[model samples]
Target: MIGGILVLAAMLLTGTLTFWQQVERALADNAYTFANSYLDMAVTLAGVLMVLRGLVYVLRMQRELRNFKDDTWSCLELLIHGLRDDVRSIRRHLPIMLGGLLLLGLLSRLQLILGGVGFNDGWAELILVGIGVLMVYAFFRYRLQVHVRPRLEALEAVRRELAGDSLKPDDL
Candidate 1:
């Protein structure tokens, strides 16, 4: 999912950059009217694409959750097999995520120090970082509710049943 978003963002940035270049060309040719129209169109198109991408993302997430709930036995099996590795992987990625955020901040500060003017006030990157954090939190919550807790409860029940069986006096 993150990969899909990154790819979409890259494509949008490419399209926007291409439109910006066309605007520059129009201005260089003294076609101010054409430049203004193209700039407006580019901004509008980018905004629409962003909104559409967000809607698609939400729809995809909902579909995934539904599918997950439908095949919870598979989810439980996966958790049983890989829960420890999943946890260790998450632990490893935490520092990477934090480092990426720190690097983003440092780069933004460095650009400012170098008298570089950005297109926006860095709010876009901050929002992306915030969303990433929220997604990670949501994933953990979902796993706990849907996978880990259920599996733990199942194991507990099995243990209790075994204990009760051992207490029976028939085959001793």
Candidate 2:
């Protein structure tokens, strides 16, 4: 869902910028040209940063999952299995999401680079950027909810199991 939102934002931003550039070219306005370029640069930079951040998060999650299996707790053992499965799911989907975002960012950057497009500030742009921000937030939530929490639960379960306590599914 977050991936879908990011892709949508990328598409909207790219289209808006391209159309705005065409309109600017038609008018041949010299005003605010530098500001427009900077804005475009900022958006591109933000998107790239998001991709890098996501990659880092995925790497960190993988490392944690690796450590999880080595823990001695019986509950952790169960958790390790579930976490492994979760990590696998994340690994499968994350690269595709990153690739799509990267492609969108690249295409947007290309438009700015080759077309010398002018970007004016508008409410629509703000909304789209906000959506992009929300998508990032959603991704973070997914990582925590799907990956981190499960691993932590597994570890806790292992601890309980080692302590000779039975675990409920809710305990997990």
Candidate 3:
């Protein structure tokens, strides 16, 4: 917060000097030029810092993606082994939902072709359908990750260790 205040102060000071050049000799003629140059340098430096911050953000996101990949794979293995029932439940529901959506798509197309629906040919209808499908998929993913999958994986891990066929350190 202090750094932000300093940056704001520097910017405001520069702006005031630039706009009110006649109020002070330090902001007149070559003195003004020098001060203005310094302000430009400060602004450029700030921009460079922002770019560096963006690079750091990207680096952190990349690291997170790698970690998520490892975790997701481990969880998937556990789900397959220990939570067959839950996985089967998801698999059963997902296909039916997908099929229903697909049927709606066909119906929409047919309506457009036959002039049976007002929105049959419009891009808006198609976009709405696309968004709806995406929302459904997102919900499914959330449920799999947070609701049914974690417990299943934990149980599977415990079962494996009990059977003396435990996972390697790298697997965990």
lDDT of 2 at 55: 53
Question: How many backbone collisions does model 3 have?
Answer: 0
**Residue 98 lDDT (model 1):** 47
TM-score of each: 0.35, 0.37, 0.37
Off by over 4 Å in 2: 1-35, 54-121, 163-172
Estimate the Cα RMSD of every predicted model relative to the unseen true structure.
Answer: 10.8, 12.7, 20.4
lDDT (Cα) of model 1: 0.54
Local accuracy of candidate 2 as per-residue lDDT tens digits, 1-172: 4575576567656655765674565358655443344346446545555555555455555565676556466435555655555565456555566455445544554555565554534334544655675676578568868767766676766677677678666876
Q: What local lDDT does model 2 show for residue 2? A: 57
Give the Cα lDDT of each candidate. 0.54, 0.56, 0.53
Candidate 2 achieves a global lDDT of 0.56
Error of 3 at 59 (Å): 46
If both were scored by lDDT, which would come out higher, candidate 1 or candidate 3? 1
Q: After TM-score superposition, what is the CA distance of residue 66 in candidate 2 from its true location, in Å? A: 6.4
Tell me the spans in candidate 3 whose CA falls farther than 4 Å from its real position. Answer: 1-82, 115-123, 164-172
How many clashing pairs does model 2 include?
A: 4
